[model samples]
Target: MTQDLFDPFAPVPETPAKSGNTPEFSVSDLSNALKNTVEDAFSFVRVRGEISGFKRASSGHMYLALKDDKAVLDGVCWRGQAGKLGLVPEDGMEVIVTGRLTTFPGRSKYQIVIETMEVAGEGALLKLLEERKKKLAGEGLFDADRKKPIPFLPDVIGIVTSPTGAVIRDIMHRLRDRFPRRVLLWPVLVQGNGAAEQVAEAVRGFNDLLPYGHIPRPDVLIVARGGGSLEDLWAFNEEVVARAVAESDIPVISAVGHETDTTLIDFVSDLRAPTPTGAAEKAVPVRGDLIGQIEENGLRLSQAVRRLGVEKKTALESLARGLGDPKRMLEERNQMLDNWADRLPRSAVNVVSQARARLNETSARLVSPREQLSEKRGRLENAAVRLDGAMKSALQMQQARLDRASAGLRPSDAKRDVDRAGKQIMDLGARMGAAVKNTLTREAEGLARYDRLLESYSYRNVLKRGFAVVRDGAGNLVEKSADIVTGQGYDLEMGDGVTRVTAGDATTEPASTPTAPTSGGARDGDDMPVDAVASSKPETVSKPKAVKKKDPQPKDDDRQGSLL
Candidate 1:
């Protein structure tokens, strides 16, 4: 087998091309050698894999594991390199990491030292953005109610974006084309690792500006950037930037990219514009358009004023026609007064004359006092003379009868007759005196009873019976408790004196005897006497004591029942 070069077990003859001496190395030396060789072999590499176990250290260095279906690799992005990337690496996020492969000599494991990192593709970036959007949406960060209305015109507009970018240039150009506005520029990086933080700071800084400070505060705000790849425009999508936009006091207009590009800032902003130029248009109205609108309104106002003037003039003319002459009206009224004045004195004279005639007729019908008195005196005198004459005649007649009887009788008989006559006269006189005394006694008793009856009905008597006469402050008698209003002061008149007291809202009825119901109706609690209720002032009023029932007396035939 001269051709055993391919055979693994075949022994071959030694050749004469060998040096005897070789360099020796330790395990650490060998490891360092492999490390250098591997780092050099793959100096710059771009890898596409799903990121796993991504962690950012306190040192600002990012470490992660990148994995495909079958294998896994370790990767690290140092602080400087990490800061250059626009996107943050998230676990399970597919990414393209560009770096040098190197080994850690101590651990003897190889890893990629990432110089730059990006999402694997637009699809991967969108997927990550979608997941982030879902998370933020769950927190109600994208609520429509949070959106504020953009001002039609602002005093000053503050912009957070790159100062020298085309986005700013477009906004300024558009603003100049429409209405010029005062602008304040807060220069910030539009994309990259710290771009989100810069944008957030700029927004917060603008809000913190004072109106009276050296730099005037802006009335509205704009966060703008030109359209680019997802990686290039990703700063606007950061949670920090979105939160800053949402919490800004001033209304914010976001113009982040082309019309088709969507970002998180768009949802949280007060208004979203397709482009920076569009944002400028939304912020203020066109100068020419505003002038035309004002002119149109002025024309309408003038027309309205002219119409009003014509209507007022017509109303004035109509009013002038409706008004009669004031002098003529006054004359007519004066004539009426004159007619009444002329008739008044004549009518008064007629009334007085008729009254005088009636007075004369009435006087004639009346009896004069002197004549009536004289007539009465004459009648009295005539009656007295008649009475005296009749008495004398009767006495004389009696004397003659007596003389005749005396002549016809013996001395003894005459003496007896005289005695009998004397006895009869004495008896008659005694009887007259007794009757007069009895009549006087009866009349006196009647007068005493009449006086007693009068006294009983007197107000003094009523007052003496422990009853009071209540009167208001004005001295008007209050017959019922309802007559006294709260806060009013009244006088209570007892037999001895009057007392003034303030009235309270508590209502009290005069002490009423509880009568047994003939109709057998049950009495409710309200029907019970309020006298049982405590008095606010004990000294002013005494509570009513319940009266005990008395036995009924037998009815008298002539007795009249009186309701007391």
Candidate 2:
């Protein structure tokens, strides 16, 4: 190797002498000095170390340190912004933390903010039981009351686990041995970050997809995973996983982790099994045992039916034996029985003949009454029919007679009715007239009789008793006997309208003096003075005028005429 400043294959280098510092430089040049020089100087930093200190804050911030036999470097995490560290940082944990070199200005310290923290070999299994407990408890998944009861026998089953995992294989094997039936598998992640959501989705989907009625709605379910650390089984403790188990209508059999490892799903499940195989066994009855039991029950049912049949037959046989028939014992007596039977037929014939004789006698006796009854019935029926015809004819004749009578009596009855009414009116009028006449006559007769009695009885006594009469100058009868006019023309009516009397004169027997004239016409005896005519004549009657006739003209006219 020749020591030369220039390369034959490239341009020679130019040297610049050191000069005083200039007040000029590009920001890129200074940045480039730090970036490139620091990058080149600290590039490929091989950190062969052991983890000394570790911290995980409640804020999910990780703080740690890396140290070798000589020196140590501080490491920090800015919350959860990366994948999980391969190993937990504890004292004496071999690791290699890879990251870009950076400086902290607070103390101007250079450190490595870990982009990756890898442990050399296997560190330790994360036995985060407290965290697991807290996670499961926070979900309230360990409540026993939330557990559903597993169906005694399921027609359909749903298994949520890895399809290729031994868990499914074990369950299938155990189920075949127990129930020997097909099981539905929903392949899902069971050991990673998405394990809880995947397993929960599978459980919910089976429940959501279940059919109606009991035609076997995925009757039981199993959530399973192989054994691992708490982190490996942590997905089952998530709220999604726990609530999935709790919300299942079908019974959930939680088969996760080792038997010693407990999970939140195990508490909330209807039944918990140590392994997936155990869960399958718990879910179904052994098919062989079930078959045996069914066969035994069928045998017992057949035996019971046969026993009942035998008992019924025996009872029937006993009943038959108890009914003794005489025909069964009539062996040697066949001929005698036949003869007796023949005699029976002959005796029965004789009895029948006697019965027939009695029946004939009774029949003969009843025949007379029956015949008489029949004749009477026939006569009664004939009479009834004849009576009906006669009644009809009589009704028709009576109807015709009534019509004829109505027709004949119409005009005569009308005339008689009018006549009767007229007669009634005439009778009423005659009665009224007669009543009036009778009343008038009775009153007149009463008056006349009374007057006649008064005159005949009273005047007879007055005249017979020599009651004398006197006159006034005017020829008026003197009511009192003190009236004294010697001579005046006057009329003296005794009991009758006639009387004989003498005349008295004043001086001598005077002749009939003539009356003097006045304004009135000359009246015969009316104007004659008493002194003038002292003498007068009295009238004499030939026959007594019976029952005086009243003048048609008024008597007052005569008086007035005399005055005039």
Candidate 3:
């Protein structure tokens, strides 16, 4: 029994085999068969699923996996078809794809060859839009600080919209109504199939225009389109379009769809208009209103200037009132000139007398020329005697030295030394004479200056300027009005001659003040005759009151007065 136990590796006895009819297939042939079957069965199908593992190849083909929770079906969108699909497919996007089912023999896999694709529903489109917004916002593309300010008045306006749509017509009509401006139309597809790419390219093209070239660069850009559904307006919401709007150097005004409709470009643009017409309104101001405002401002400025002039004139008039009468001021200045004139003659006489006294004193201190010459002659005689004695002694010493040095001494050298000494003496005498002449000339110039100064200080100059001196009976100056006594005789010293006149009684009180009337005379403020007033005070003479004088020719109020 142990020997008969299982032999695991032993060969078993063979039996005759019978075969039935069945089909055989290679890997290539089987894969081809299945592909054809799938193509025929689901040739035109719309499959709804969330996209996964989405990839765009360099060959311009898109490969993606369409997946629900339970299963995934591979899908491919050729380059030509992918662009026709309005929206780009992204991972996690719920989409409906219309295509034929096919199999790849190389990988032995089945896939959907996508002809067209779209967001599965409104909810899916909104979700995709929101997700993309969040992603771009996180990158700071929607930041308010990144947005440029719109120009109040743009020179050239660039519009990106469909060429034949009512949106452009509406914008142009609105602009014409408000203000006329140069409009550059960058025609683009506003919706469907490659619309987003066209919009992006149009924006970039407008920005690329040279500012000072054949084409004028736009100061502002308007991306406008008519009202439509979210899907129809999705071209403006694409990330490519949004990014182009954000990076534009010119300010962008987004006006897409209706007022309630929103897009990603609207967030990144400098301004968002509710409608295409609204965008035009934002681009320029009402011309008539601007002209009216300018005219109003000009009127206001003129009024302000006139008012300022009136105020300054009033201020000047008030200041002029504070200044005393100009005639009285001139009289006072003339009196001052008279006083200066009276002192000038005396000052000049004193200066001349002092200078003359100094000259006499200096002359008294000087020695006589004859005595000076005699003293100098005695000194010269003494010097000559000393020289004679010194010369004799020096000659004796030289004779002793000559006995030893005459062997090498030259008579020609001695003669040359003597000639040089004589030449030096002549030069010194000439210089001394020139120095004395210069000193005399300087002293004469100084004397001339003093003489001119004395003449300048003379009172005759003051008299020539129409000033006169007033002196009392005692020949003392009556320098002020208070110094003149009633019935006193005084001398008026003019430049040519002097006249004597008795001073009349002077008024002590101001003209504006009232004085008590004399006994049996008219009361104050009474306009009585001058002769009658004099007759009333027969014993005592009454001086006329000094009235404040008014300007005879008043200055024009419009003329600017001198500050001085």
Candidate number with greatest lDDT: 3
How would you encode candidate 3's per-residue C-alpha lDDT over 398-462 as one tens digit per residue? 99898888688889999999999999999999999999999999999999999887654555433
Considering lDDT, which of the candidate structures 2 and 3 is the better prediction for this target?
A: 3
Error of 1 at 549 (Å): 78
- Using TM-score as the measure, which candidate wins? 1
Structure candidate 1, residue pairs in collision = none
Tens-digit lDDT track of model 2 for 290-345? 89999999999999999999999999999989987678667656877887877887
Compute the lDDT of residue 251 as modeled in candidate 1: 91
Candidates 1 and 2 compared by TM-score, better number: 1
| Overall lDDT per candidate, in order of appearance | 0.77, 0.64, 0.79
Which stretch of 10 consecutive residues in model 1 shows the poorest summed lDDT? 545-554
Each model's TM-score? 0.53, 0.40, 0.53
TM-score of 1: 0.53
Model 2, TM vs. native: 0.40
Model 1, 58-161: lDDT tens per residue? Answer: 99999999999999999998998887676778899998888899999889899999987777888877888899899888988889998888888898999898
* Pairs with backbone N, CA or C atoms under 3 Å apart (clashes), candidate 3: none
Query: Which scores better on lDDT, 1 or 3?
Result: 3
